[model samples]
Target: MPAEPPVDPMTDRELRADARRNREQVLATAQRLFAAQGLGIPLDEIARRAGVGPGTVHRHFPTKQALYLAVAIDQIRRLVDEGEALAATDDPAALFTLLSRMMASGAENAAVKSALTAAEFDLRDAAPDAAAGLTHQVARLLDRARQAGVVRDDVTVDEVMAIVAGAFAAIRHAGADTSPERSAHLARIILDGLRPPSRR
Candidate 1:
């Protein structure tokens, strides 16, 4: 009998590219369905919408918590990216506008919002590498904004996360008709409080 060849693990670059495509497709479909219905939609439905099989979904996400974690992490990465992109704009209002828009859009996606909330409940620390990278990126943008006199020095990253968590709670309680405009308005109000007091 001939010996069977051992299967090899995917190369890092190939794995990353595959994961990126799968993640993007899952998020896009999940966002559309969740926005239309809510987070209560079945995982099977999400898989179907994404044109993937249930087994494939499970392979990517062993449980709802895993799926939620993936979504929350992706969202955080996106926000951090957007923040960094706007960090050098030299326009406080523009930066604020971009932040507000992101917050509003975030409020509408029930799956992503629920995932963020679940992440809070899980409270397991992020993996060291991911945590460090996200912290560095977010902190860099925040420090720049504070130095530019746009964001208040007293507003810590923890406080910003708290506000985001609260916003998700508000949306969940309010239901699908929850207005993104209202969430944006509320986020602006919260951000206003985080702004440094005017030097008299």
Candidate 2:
């Protein structure tokens, strides 16, 4: 009999699909657990919640810090995607709309807040590539709004980001008594201040 080609237990496509699913499951599980229990939660617990073995989790992320950084990187990447999408819009008010949406969502995003405030993970150093992309997208969006006369002509991207960071910080520190409506109202107030003198 002609020698049969070595039979692979799993095809390349199947292996890739399995890896993809495992990665997604790990991320989702980690995000949920971290948000509920804080970033101090262990990797094995995340693996348990993800229904994957500890080895599997390590195979994907290698370390808890790696997983945490991955989560933060993913969040930053998503913000960049959103910023890019809004930058493509013709609406003069799209920039503030994006800010409003971010503020609203920030109220519920504990994992991101933790990542931002964490001393252990310096996101700027750890994910410089992703951070720079996000910064560029945000600057592009602000420029679009400025050129449309929606935002102040003198407002720079760094200044705008500083304001946004403060606003998100406020939202993070706000008591449970503070409603989402109140958060939106506060965000709108900031947005109002960002508008051109003529628009105010």
Candidate 3:
């Protein structure tokens, strides 16, 4: 029998890289679709928009619930990244920048979040590491802000979380999920409450 050709290590690495790219594209497309049209969008449609085969999406996310959770987790992980980047800065008010991003990110992915909530899924349970990392980042920033007297010393990381949750609720209650301007306005009002009282 003729000897089989040896597999190229570079080829395997290239294939893996291509798969990663495809997965990222699918995730981004599904996130945009779910945000714009809700979770009713078909997996096939997401693959189509992502320029990948249907099997690609199915291989990565077997069902709508899986996709929803992945999207939610991805959103949080990105926020954690942003928070980490902000923490490296000298700006004490970087806390506001990170919190602002968290608010905006949650609002943008509200539809996916609603679906996960309906399914009784919490990111803290589904993705413990990323969830805890996000909280830790927030805590670090909060501590720095407090030390700088930019934010109220009385506020704990837990309270900051509750306030963000409340802000999201308020935004949804006002039917402002589709309106970035309105959502931002509401978020500002709630975040403003975090500022320390004037010494004057």
Alpha-carbon local distance difference test for all models: 0.64, 0.75, 0.83
Which wins on lDDT, candidate 1 or candidate 2? Answer: 2
Per-residue CA lDDT of candidate 3, range 79-177, in tens? 889889999999998988888877777788853344223334776678889778988999999999999999988999988977776777788899988
lDDT of 3: 0.83
Off by over 4 Å in 1: 1-23, 92-102, 114-134, 168-177
Q: Rank the candidates by TM-score, best first.
A: 3, 2, 1
* Estimated TM-score for each candidate: 0.68, 0.83, 0.90
TM-score of 1: 0.68
C-alpha positional error of residue 20 in candidate 3 after TM-score superposition, expressed in Å: 0.8
Question: How far in Å is the alpha carbon of 112 misplaced in model 3?
Answer: 6.5
Q: Of the candidates shown, which would achieve the greatest lDDT relative to the real structure?
A: 3
RMSD to the native, candidate 3?
Answer: 2.6
